[model samples]
Target: MPKMKTHKGAKGRVKVTARGKVVAYKTGKRHLNYKKSGKTIRLKGKKFVLFKGDARKFRVLLPYDWR
Candidate 1:
């Protein structure tokens, strides 16, 4: 048997919460801010839980994150 490797890219971009929920920052926060509204920029800075389907995918990438 072999251990699974964590996906480095996902490791840097995603976070696993204490409850095992996967979270990630909303996109569109970087670049071209001048064209986006203030509210849009503010919302983009917040972290949001990934949808169930997506979270499952990230879980595989972050196997050791589950406690």
Candidate 2:
């Protein structure tokens, strides 16, 4: 069978952790940072684990187990 192609867009945005969980960075840090507090900006820099339902969807896009 042919291998599935990894989604480039998802590859760049989300990542799989050592525990096989899908984590993605929070948005709203790209623009208008002047109005956002420093803590808010800092928090956005961190990656958050996706919900079970959402993670399952990401898994399909990131076949071959990216870690």
Task: Point to the candidate with the largest lDDT.
Answer: 1
In model 1, state the lDDT of residue 57.
89
Tell how far residue 56 is off in model 1, in angstroms: 0.6
The runs of at least 3 residues in candidate 2 whose Cα sits more than 4 Å from the true structure, single-residue gaps closed, are: none
| Steric clash pairs (candidate 2) | none
lDDT of 2 at 35: 92
Per-residue C-alpha lDDT of model 1 across residues 1-67, encoded as one tens digit per residue: 8999999999999999888888899998889999999999999999998999999888788889887
Worst 10 residues of 1 by lDDT: 58-67
The Cα error of candidate 2 at residue 41, in Å, is 0.9
Instruction: Estimate the Cα RMSD of every predicted model relative to the unseen true structure.
Output: 0.8, 1.5
Cα TM-score per model: 0.93, 0.89
Residue 13 error for model 2, in Å? 0.8
In the range 1-65, model 2's lDDT, one tens digit per residue, is: 98899999989988888889888999999999999999999999999998999998988888977
Error of 1 at 36 (Å): 0.6
Relative to the unseen true structure, what is the C-alpha lDDT of residue 11 in candidate 1, on a scale of 0 to 100?
97
- The pairs that clash in candidate 1 are none
